[model samples]
Target chain A: MKVYAIYILNKAGGLIYQNDINPGLNKLSANDYLVLAGTIHGVHAIASKLKPTEFEPSSKPFGGEKEIPIESSATFSSSISVRDSTINNDVVNGRWNNPNTNNTGLRSIETDLFNVYVFQSLTGIKFILITSPNPIVHNVASLNLKINKGELNRQFDLAKEIFHNIYVTYSDYVMKDPFYSLEMPIKNNLFDSKIRELAK
Target chain B: MIYSFSIFDRHCNCIYNRRYIHDGPLLTQSKPSSVNLKNSIGDPLGVSITSLPPDNGSGDNFSPLGITTKSKESGSSSAINGPIPGYINKYNDSNASKLLFGIMYSLKNITAKLGDLASLFNTLKSFSTENFRVHFMESATGLKFVLATDNEVDNLQHILKELYTNYYLNHVVYNALSPVEFGTDANEHGKISNSDFINATDSFLTSLSVFK
Candidate 1:
């Protein structure tokens, strides 16, 4: 759960900001970082296109009526189960209230050593977080057991919180600066300190 | 449910590829209304495929406006039906397979380089988009097994290992007539054409709980 690095890409897919929060990951050259950012941006776009087609059921007169209730109940039970296991009801409610705001592109990449999470804002700015693999996932990898969905959801919730904080800080410090130009590299000292604080 | 499975040889050549056509109740429930509407309006799948824009290789210039415009057009034109899922034998050389391999290759390399240099097997295991999750496993011999399933599915490493040690070893590796390595030339691309192996894999995969 250690954040290794953070990369911010503008709406045009340009790397506007890059920071190494921790020392676990190897440092990439500035040019290489730009390439990485561009690559991620490209991959994110391509991934949306690669989305698999949903299964379309054959025509049935009564099929629609029977299926709706069951599906709704399944979601209801799942949500209830999740809520029962955690005290953070507000986060769950917040997630459900605005489902469309969820980024419909590449979300996370998990590896043996680390995980990369991509959070795209409504304006299309991408917040990329490279971190150590979730401890729950690591445990499942070693134990060869079924992954606990609750733990994974908690990890995602934590990530969402971090991204939300980062977004708020960005809007406050970067967006409000009179000298800062849109889509340009961020160079604010206050913003830098806020990011560092969040990392800590 | 699992949508597709692919195997890449050490050379990064896709040796075996299988996509499952999933029309089950579980899959339909995800977006019931849209799928039903699309299906009822006379085979949107075929229409979508035919109307797909050509690959102009301009993915690098991805902008928010471009994505929104494209999605909106597609959404309005056809009710957004994804490609069918099933263990189909043909179309292994599709651009999707190539792109998938390219992604895995680059991401694996990046992960290995970024991690502690002393560790030997620092490879990418899985990546999830909003649509699906891809579970990956690589043998010491460099055969890569990739499984793309719905986001609910968890790590499939053990399943992959079982396929390797049990099915793959017994069917492809030990068979006397089978080629030792997949393809040497560009045309053939070293596809695994063994029916027994294919059938075994199909049955084994279908038997899994997640497959239902």
Candidate 2:
């Protein structure tokens, strides 16, 4: 769970802030980093688009049809009505649950080398956390060596807490600063020190 | 339940890709020559049928027969080249690999921003979700290996290193048909088409307990 780097991208996909907490990466030009941020933002959009769409049946009422036996028609109409209502209810519930579908464009991408966690604010600002691979400590270990599920949850909980604190610090030191401009590079000393503290 | 294994050169060009299917018998889309090689190395008779074992279930001894049987069944031979049903192309579509490369590229640079004695920058190693785990390893020359497994896997760095040393370096880098390219996706000519590499990698991946 080592966080190697962190990046912040504006809603427009511009690189607003970048920090490297650990060493071991090669250097890239300033322009290249912006390009990388934009590319990730674009890919995240595409990934959101690529998410599988849930199937939903149309809820339109059945049109007029030839009369059949009362019993058969009653059963057929009742089944259709039931299906329609269920579909309608699902649509209603889905919309209520996820009003902003694109609020978080790219959630995470897991690779053999590292895990990237993306935290997108309600305002569309994105925070990307690049962390070392999560340990599979018990993959081949003895049964006694397995870490409890609660411990794993606690590790992730810590990560979430760190990200939240970073967001809070950003809002205070970077966002509210009178001199700071939107989508500009963050160079505030307070923000930097606070980030360093969080990383530590 | 391992999904696939892919090897990328420093430029993020996918050099070798093998998708593993578990819903049915382990089937792959590898060519015929690779299949023959696997048959020779894995299971000559194809009599072994491997079952899905419990994840992290310890105390059960890892049987040599079980390992060989799995290798034979999952071998990417020429005969079983059928349309894979659960097969997933997670990266190629939507240029996800390009984005992946860009993220790592910038990360390395930022990490190196501060002066360090080692002259090294740490990059992302691996990430997992509830469903799958991806293990990543990079060689000294920038070649990166990615393995996406559905179950937990251990010692993946060693596996990646072995694959790089035993297969990629020997077969692709040293092969006459392929020439290494920089900063560009490895086109078909640059891809690892060697049958021996594919066979060796298939056997190695299948031997992992996570490949069930």
Candidate 3:
């Protein structure tokens, strides 16, 4: 849940807003930030358009599905009976319905230091969320559950929430203001404070 | 208690719309109507739809010109029928979806006029009063996401964004069949056809706290 920095790019790949919430990452020059935003935007466009290479599933889907029922059977039945099964079904179905199936859109790139997540708005604005790598590994290990795709998907979903909030804030505080021109840099104090609040 | 959700493109055309009916408490407080009274003046007991419920009261204070009713009534006549007649309705009897989009569109433009503070004024995310809350999210390109919910719902911006990411972008924008071209749809106007996205949205929304 530790977001390193956030970068917001306009439709033309211009850096409209950039902030480093958790300091320590090497800072880039103003020009360099622009380049970074453009590069990421281009790469995301290319990636999203890339045709996926299908690979055979190494293990059968049912093999993994059977394990969940037996492991959490007791807890599953004790909850709200209506939703428990649907939740379980989502977990199972999500295994095959990975949103990043094509591997086209840049989802995340992980390193020992940090993880970069790219969220593209419908109109081509890109929100880049850089977070600490392996934020959930220790917790998952302590829980004694084998870390897998499910864990990563949950993390991705959480990052989407962060990006979503940022998007909302950006649209409200930046887009509505009559003084703010499109594709221009955002410098409002309220927007900055709101971003800081979200970081906290 | 969200009754409906809608998305409008930059041009203000409704791109996606869906209605959710809940059996729980209605957000608008319907007034007790004096109905079924004998007409001493010889007029038939035709339903006059009197007391067409307060449009959630003070929310319409912004419409000083009194134009919302004239415009909304004309547009709604063809699209919407009153919902069971007894409940106070936030929108008019015509097209509830269109009115929602119209309000959001006008509000977006009005709020964007803050000049230097304009940068401080971001898009209208959501505005809630009394029992009803309407959630909103706009993309940099002005694509708007709107949803109506009960005031108790939290983190709804995430859900709206999820709808933008998982549903709209994936199904409408990415799908070649459903081109990003607005104005007219080759398939159907203001209709989205991706079942995968719809089902996922249905499940996700139904699992919300507001629904319960």
Q: Which candidate achieves the best DockQ against the true structure?
A: 1
Give lDDT tens digits, candidate 1, residues B1-212. 66777888988777897766544332232222322333422232222211122231111111111111122222221331223323343445655676677777777766776776576483677877765788888899999998887777757777787788888999999999888888666555278878788788888887777774
Q: How accurate is candidate 3 locally (lDDT)?
A: 0.51
Which stretches of model 2 miss by more than 4 angstroms? A1-7, A15-116, A129-155, A166-200, B9-13, B24-117, B121-124, B127-134, B140-142, B150-155, B169-191
Instruction: Point out the worst 10-residue segment of candidate 1 chain A by lDDT.
Output: A63-72
Number of the predicted model whose TM-score against the real structure is largest: 1
Candidate 1 segments exceeding 4 Å error: A55-102, A141-153, B26-85, B120-122, B185-189
* CA shift of B16, model 2, Å: 2.2
For candidate 2, the lDDT comes to 0.51
Docking band of candidate 3: incorrect
Q: Candidate 3 on B1-212: residue-level lDDT in tens? A: 45556666777666665555343222211111234333311222131222122333311111110111222232222333233211122222223345455545544443342111315333344433222446678877777787765444432556677778877777677877765655464344445545665566667666665553
User: Cα-based RMSD of the predictions, in order?
Assistant: 10.2, 14.6, 21.4
lDDT of 3 by residue, A1-200 (tens): 78778888888889888888886355667876776676666645433322111111223222112121111123223233535446667787662121211123445543334556777665566788877656443223322322222344466678877876887888799888889987778888899889989977
Q: Please compute DockQ, using alpha carbons, for every candidate against the native two-chain complex.
A: 0.23, 0.06, 0.01
Q: After superposition, how far is residue A12 of candidate 2 from its true place, in Å?
A: 1.7
The digit string of per-residue lDDT tens for model 1 on A65-157 reads 333222123323544454555546566665422121223357888876778888886567899988888765655653353544434446666
lDDT of 3 at B112: 45
lDDT by candidate, in order shown? 0.65, 0.51, 0.51
Better of 1 and 3 by lDDT: 1
